[model samples]
Target: MKLLTCPLNGQRNITEFTYGGEYHPMPDHQQASSREWAEHVFFHDNNAGIVIEWWCHSASSYWFLAQRNTISDKILRTFPADEIFNQRVDFAPAPEVSSEAAPTTKGESC
Candidate 1:
């Protein structure tokens, strides 16, 4: 099974995750025709390069964006849940922080 990392916890697992979609946004509802809407909702772009995606951590009940290299299983970066729907590509890897930035021993760290 494909596993996603919780942007909050950093640990890799399945139960704590969900695949929202590749980070491409669709046109506004008012601007798109029915056919365009259908295509946007059902079709897959699957761009073969770096992709940003939303991963909802159900177990932790948090949402976040993850940047991953589609050609490789490498997770490039992750950001706060609220930043998922934003039209920003500045979501690159963060500066390596020491243990201070590590997930606190609060949640299940999954």
Candidate 2:
């Protein structure tokens, strides 16, 4: 059976982990347009070289990052997510529209 090391739990069966996705740095949320956001969320480079990716220890719910070779399908190393994402990405809720501006909210009383 294949094995994968968890930065927090040490070596474990690969079955215990979940492949999150490619660990690409997020785009500037404040400056990125809707199209850019769509592309970032939906697209993957699928590069053949070594790339950092997000992985989770399913049993413990511990998430981490791993460096893997796409062509070889081998994980080189694994580390905590905080090592790369030092800051959290918060999506601010859209401003609520007033009754005067939105027809849907005019008579809908909940």
Model 1: CA > 4 A from native: 1-5, 10-15, 84-110
TM-scores, all candidates, are: 0.60, 0.82
How many pairs of residues in model 1 come into backbone collision? 1
Model 1 worst lDDT window (10 residues):
83-92
Candidate 2, residues 1-110: lDDT per residue as tens digits?
99999999999999999999987777899999999988899999988989999899998999999999988889899989888778878989999998789757456787
Best prediction by TM-score: 2
How many pairs collide in each candidate, listed in order?
1, 0
**Model 1's TM-score against the true structure:** 0.60
Could you say which candidate leads in lDDT? 2
The regions of model 2 sitting more than 4 angstroms off are 97-110
Cα lDDT over the full model 1: 0.74
**Residue pairs in clash, model 1:** 63-81
